[model samples]
Target: MKYCLSFLLVSLFTSCKYFDVEKTTSEAILKEELKTFNWNDVDTYPSFSICDSLISKSEKKECFQNNLSSHILKFLQDEVIVVTQDIHDTINLQFKVSEKGDLTLLEAKVDSLTVKEIPNIYELINNSLNTLPTIYAAIKHDQYVKTEFELPMVIKVE
Candidate 1:
């Protein structure tokens, strides 16, 4: 009788499902819920007015960048910025687009010497950015979030 009772108790305890420690907790679920998504892996790229109707992600991104560069180049041409010397420099432009489609020029990293040599450079860039039409902000995780962009432009003066 003692042996039978002991065997029954051992089997009952071993077969119980309550001791499973692999169950997920609310905190673990909450952490997963609060995870952030990488901006580079966004479903859609930010759009300009000209590229807003494009269906493909790559097309939209390419079109937006092309249009922006075209606008800047056009502005420079209009300003008649003649390259007097043979100099090569890359300018890094940092800007932001708001959720409401407003665009802001954060900073421009141009050679100070170049700027000194070419007066009105800053003004031209600022004016060009201000003249740009409203831009559709990038969508991340289905939300229209403000996004920052870093554009590197190589300028070759001949």
Candidate 2:
């Protein structure tokens, strides 16, 4: 009976050590992954040709936004044909850039009044996106990643 008790105690202690080793190994692996994981933020913002020369993160963002707005404005001015009295409206443009560096329009929300005033707004927006130049995809964790952008476009007719 004493020998059996000793064996049971030794086996329990040995099994505990095995579990401890496994636990330590798992914790170490988790810690190592945490060190490399980036929480919901990208290493680099999406780039535009005009912004590619910029080295500062904030400047790159600003340049990208400015150029995007300019591109949309130019398309609206040059391609879209609208007839309306003095009116102002805003459209929210939501789009995604693919990992393959292609742009896709997710949504374009223009008010009913604007739609009535400019009947072809939807077609115009689609055409604008189709004509837009190729865009660079965003970089996250040193890899190209798909990213979405929501831009508010305000149009004023005088």
Candidate 3:
């Protein structure tokens, strides 16, 4: 009787289902995330000239735009995985670049994305931007150079 009782107790305990650890919401993931930039050691491109005398302000702005686009594209290519069929659709990201060229990630709104999804979407963009290599450029004497930049992104569900 004792042996049977012990076996029964052991089996009961062993067969019981343990509560699962709750999965974190996308917001939580976004809030606490830190992305790292991984530039290819051998194939890294040279930094562009920031102080070219011949380059006009418009040209310098174009350079900045191109640099930012390339950085974002490389990130999406390497780290992101698109899960949706309509992943090719573009999402406009409205943000500001400080005089120091630091990005302040702001509100992200899309027709396809629900209000709840906005936080996650913004987080993803922020992570991608954080991982991009820095562009060290001397902005010509324009006090508080705040520029708005829009970049197209293809979202992956994964």
Candidate 4:
């Protein structure tokens, strides 16, 4: 009878060490992930071939934006736009970068004056993107994602 009790006590004390491991709940794990999650941010912005060589995130973004702006500006400058009135305004050009890196013009917000002077300004800007080199979609968690961008273009003509 004494031997049985000793065996039971030793077994119970030895089992306590196995139960010492801390248990994690699913809700706690989910909460932890949420705490570290980025709500509306991407790991990497959509990249262009010209901008791809950049190592820094801000540099890549700047290069992407500048390259796009330069392309549109060059296209606009090449066209001889004759206006009777001295026009100075900004155009908010909105576009979407698809999962396949296709740039689609969503909208062009231009004042009535600018539209009247350059009726085909939207078409011209859209065409500039069409001529762009290959672009890669944005990356988030190692997956490609679509993104939207709005570029404010200032038009100052004498």
Each candidate structure's count of clashing pairs: 0, 0, 2, 0
TM-score, model 1 to reference:
0.73
Give the CA lDDT, 0 to 100, for residue 11 in model 4. Answer: 100
The model with the greatest lDDT is 4
Q: Give the distance in Å from residue 64's predicted Cα in candidate 2 to where it truly belongs.
A: 1.4
User: Which residue pairs clash in candidate 3?
Assistant: 82-156, 83-157
lDDT (tens digit, per residue) of candidate 2 on 119-153: 88878777777776667888986789988888888
Clashing pairs in 4: none
Cα distance off (Å), candidate 4, residue 2 = 4.9
* Total backbone clashes of candidate 2, pairs 3 or more residues apart or in separate chains: 0
- How does each model score on lDDT? 0.78, 0.80, 0.55, 0.86
Rank by lDDT, highest first: 4, 2, 1, 3
Off by over 4 Å in 1: 1-28, 82-88, 156-158
- TM per candidate comes to 0.73, 0.75, 0.49, 0.78
Error of 1 at 78 (Å): 0.7
**Residues 115-155 of candidate 4: C-alpha lDDT, one tens digit per residue:** 89888887888878778888889888898889998888888
Residues forming the 10-long window of minimal summed lDDT in candidate 2: 17-26
Q: After superposition, how far is residue 97 of candidate 3 from its true place, in Å?
A: 1.6
For residue 79, give model 3's deviation from the true position in Å: 2.0
TM-score, predicted candidate 2 vs. hidden true structure: 0.75
